[model samples]
Target: MDTVKQSLKEASIFTHSQERPFKCSDCGSNFKRAADLREHERIHTEERPFSCSHCTKTFRTSSNLRQHQRVHTGERPFTCSVCGKGFTQLSSLLKHKVTHTQERPFKCSDCGRGFKSSGELMSHKRFHTAEGLFTCSVCGKGFNRSSHLQTHQRVHRFKSSSNLRKHHRVHTKEKPFPCSVCGKGFTQLSSLLKHKSTHTQERAFQCTDCGTGFESSHELLIHQRVHTGERPFSCSHCTKRFKRLSTLRIHQRVHTGEKPFPCSVCGKGFTQSSSLLRHNVTHTKERPFKCSD
Candidate 1:
């Protein structure tokens, strides 16, 4: 009877009781448990107590650190029963499960649109409100979102007609600017300038682990990942992780069956541009690789 009473008391405390004894001094947020208050206080203090063994990244909670470690291990414990899809986090799996359901619990009052979650409905409500309205002065174009206006404003950034004509190369896929070192074509002069640095053999950023030099800090950070064994980018569809986000994006194409690269000669699609280039050699009867033995 005493055990049953204790269980009932605990259940009531979680479900019905509003009394929270533990309070955060920084945020004034109340919690039923001291551990909860400690976690909440970290947000205000900007304290990251838990550190990852594999990398320099740190987290406020041990659970977050454990999740971060999965990036290196490429572990996806959460699996969907319907499609057999894997996700790194349980919350992501839960979000994926909503796609299989036809039921929309939240309905928008403004447009009568149905959404699976309350967060979606709230985002939809923003379109009906003037809360995020933005306008462009150059073209007098209106956008419901500020981000759309910012992207549209880029067209107006180039004041001169010659600069605007140069920017049009991005849409036309024109590469007038060629690198003097490798003869590699680039659409912009700025890209050609950056490409020339690769041939200079002047790598300013040096890695402490292997004494490897990189042209830029970004390149150095990516090279450091080799020594750290850190693969930060994880595929949403599978347990595979990648050191680079671009590699992860390419890996996702396997799951999505998206072949963006197409052979102009054969109209055949390839998941990667390199694959298309290799297939093009078949038409030319060029055997680049041969067995020496």
Candidate 2:
């Protein structure tokens, strides 16, 4: 009886190990769970059985489909104890925790710029290195990033012929970035800074890798990506590549046709405008309505 019990325990352990029955024919990857295997198979099969009742969106996994359906249901269950706010997904709530902690773990080794999120820091680093990624098929105006390219395309999309003619001057001009060291002018600040680094030879941003330094930490991060080859930013529309997710998002907007920002005064909507500037009499502390001097 004792031998039979031990054999049954061993058999249970073996069964646990052999639970994954599906194998990826293309990659020869084996999954430990059947549900995970199904999800993996859907990648090749393009099978989205689980769907949102609110929208026409579908998902291969039930969890993703459930999250989508919540948006239509207006149900955000994950509430914050600190702010008393709610999030539909736990990941969002975890991101919100960064605000309270005030922690910026991701730092640029080149420029020493800190960001609340990796997303923001990644965007900031792009300014240091001219990663000419976003290209225009219309007039062949190449950009270092796709977000800028998308914003530029809006000019072609909505601008009149005269406006397009006028915008060409901005392209031709040599005044995008000004030098901080010598007050010299250039079309790009990043190039000017790289030049300044030669004069000052200031490798202010030091890498965590080998303590190797550069003029901007973004350059270092971009360099590090070469080692890891982790392209987190993927094209939602296609298999196109990008360094940052925001660049991918702006690119995705090109296909989805979603623009939410609008001007309050002129009713003009822009994807990226400097600000909504309202005229104020700063010289005087006079309010006609309040009767205060």
Candidate 3:
């Protein structure tokens, strides 16, 4: 009882001290205590000590890890008070609570972009850095963001040929983005996000100072490299800079002369399957893009 009284007295003294000692160097933000300073340090460091075992993914905090584990365990403890819809995490409930308050605290620093939750900001950051780590094994293509890779992989899973053609158009469009040094084109805003990394020399997707900046933000990352100069996808022995791994494979043929694509009508050899795919249409007199039939 005496110990409790002493602790209470110390707390009262702190409240009266008028001291705000904890200050952040990166954002110039202030905190009331040292512990908060340490916690806030993780934002600048991008260090996530907590990790999930299932997918071998890392999270910044234990609370995020606990929330993620619920997805694996199917534990939906949070429920809507009015609708009774369940979520595996309390954060989900808080997000659902936004429909009631219309509160959006999280926002983008590079742009005036706002999100209802921090997770949304987490997802949104993918566009600024253009870091996509996941890859499609069959095509040997990488993406900066998982959601974009998810969206692209779905194109391959599409059962309809018509849908596939529509999906293919996304790969060959003239979409544009702001130029950090030189204005270039990108298929997704996230690729532009990763491209901005090249001009800023800002590799937020780094492992260390010696670590590289090659995390993927979208599938078909050929559109991402107008920003940075580091070319990771290369032939084991040769020196070549390719924006896409698929292009690097095609370039390797210059050394090997190994033509995988052959024209059906004339039996002519080519280095790329895309070249063959486009050439075959010419031989068949098929302007697939302009077809009225």
Q: What is the per-residue lDDT of model 1 for residues 94-176, given as tens digits with 9 covering 90 to 100?
A: 87788788767678897776776554555456578764445788778776544466678889799899889888898998999
Clash pairs detected, candidate 2 = 109-205, 109-217, 110-216, 110-217, 111-217
Q: How many clashing pairs per prediction, in order?
A: 0, 5, 20
**TM-scores for every candidate against the unseen true structure:** 0.49, 0.49, 0.32
Question: Which candidate leads the pack in lDDT?
Answer: 1
The sequence of per-residue lDDT tens digits that candidate 3 reaches over residues 1-293 is: 99999999998998788777788989988877887788789999998899898877788778889988987988888889978889986766888886556466777898866666565555556557654555876675777544356567775687888657656658777465565678787655666777777776664554333444554534324444554565778776555577676677667656544554546675445667778788777657655676568
**TM-score-best of 1 and 3:** 1
Pairs in clash, predicted candidate 1: none
Error of 2 at 120 (Å): 1.1
Model 3 off-target regions past 4 Å? Answer: 12-19, 94-293
**What TM-score does structure 1 among the candidates reach?**
0.49
* Candidate 2 weakest lDDT stretch, 10 residues: 274-283
